[model samples]
Target: MSRLTERLHRMLHADDRLDREMAAEWEEAPAGKPASLPPEEVNPDTPAEQPDWWISVPFRQGRGLRRLLVVLSVLLCVGIITVLVITAQYLPHFGQAGNPANNEVSRRYIENGMEETGAVNIVAGMILDYRAFDTLGESNVLFTAVCAVMLLLRVSADKRRSAAYQLELETDDRMYEPKNDLILRSIARLLIPCILLLGMYIILNGHLSPGGGFSGGAVMGAGLILMLNAYGFRRMERFFTIRLFRAVTVCALSFYALSKAYSFFTGANHLPSVITPGTPGMIFSAGLIPYLNISVGLVVCCTIYSLYTLFRKGDL
Candidate 1:
């Protein structure tokens, strides 16, 4: 009876060991190799072939689906081009004098724009006086974009290293220094003032000349970028700090919004305006256009500088 019990116990232990081995084999089977089969199930005379991995993955199995996708993409592009071409044919021809755009409204604006807005530059008058609201919307858009970028990219003070460390980092002249390039430095020195002067001229004379706030601001931004590249951040920060940037941008945008709101209200109501459109060709002729240009320039300048500074060092 004791010998019979021992045999039964040995059988149970063998079964358990086999079960554990099977479990381990199953766990490893999906990892590119097949589990070992029992000796009784294996047939040595006929070798078992491994199944192709690609058979389970539909994308790798055939080129037909990829070709179909490519063909459909090409067809979609062709259809879009065909639609655009057909639409273009129905559109009015370019530079046609009798086009709907050359209407009485345009004529009135052209004829009386200078007298009404006191701006010699008809384009300036049209943008700032006639379509002042549109320009305001554009300025708001710029401000919003700057705000968004700042929220996304500007690094907080807590995230930055200590001021002493930052000063040490800046003192690494080899990082972005334009060193030993005397010619380049000399040229930059010569051109920076001229660029700044040209930008100011464009902004101030926007009401009397071809350029305006946008163009002049772009030029000024370019000058600032040039100065940064040539002289480095340390020198530029002496005058154009983060505080100055905030102050200038806030003031400029506030003034623009308030003044434009007043102008829009008075013009829409056909009320008498206190602002007198000065002489047509003088420097200060346009009642609010020059001031508006300066405001826009300030906002634009701050935005450009801030963007560059933030992108370079993740702070300003």
Candidate 2:
């Protein structure tokens, strides 16, 4: 019994000594040279398995498809260019006596346009009376362009939460339009009223003179741009805002459309129309030409200003 107890004590001491030696060796091991684990404890690393066959197949197929699409697109573009070139070859030369545009229509417009449309400007008489819808379409195109710009650039009011964002807005505004420029403000103060008056004159006299909705509207838009550059957005914002822009544009377009519809309905039914060609060479002449010019000018001014503000500060 004594010998058996002595053997058990020896075994316990040996196990303790073995653990201490192993711990010491592990601690002494150099950082670059880690002590190897026992063969049974060492995990045999497996190489990273290739992605699943299904996944790899799709990636390869997608690459091939992308190349094919690119080739097809190039081929399509070339085909379209070739067709256009061929078509251009058959077109009539400019200023040819036999040109289709040199027709009875031009003669009619030149001869009786003033008496029929009450517009001293023959071109205005023809366009406003004969092709007013086209003019409306052009105005709507400008409106659409501004709307698209707003969608892309305008910032949502709800998201302006942080000081950092407000600072960024101020920085951008300052960069584009200086807050305090005495020279610019002074020049604008003198020129702005004149420019505005000139624009109004052009629009009102569209039917009486060479100027019309498109030209007059462009002039007004330019004036607005000058005002924006001279005065800061805050001053402009007191009267012109996103809501005002929307309301004015919508109302003008609506009025123009309704006016045209009424004319079309009356003409188609051979009914007496309320709108008639008033006195030629007068401010109120050309039944709807002057009014249409006003509508177009409003649309143009709002669109131009909105585009500038939205782009500058992502707000309007």
What are the root-mean-square deviations of the candidates from the true structure over C-alphas? 18.4, 20.7
Q: Give one digit per residue, the lDDT tens place, for model 2 in 212-242.
A: 7777777887888898888877788888888
Candidate 2 segments whose C-alpha is farther than 4 A from its true place: 1-102, 170-177
Deviation (Å) of 22 in candidate 1: 37
Query: Where does candidate 2 have its weakest 10-residue lDDT segment?
Result: 46-55
- Candidate 1 root-mean-square deviation in Å: 18.4
lDDT of 1 by residue, 284-304 (tens): 788899999888887887788
Q: Please report the TM-score between candidate 1 and the true structure.
A: 0.63
Best by TM-score: 2
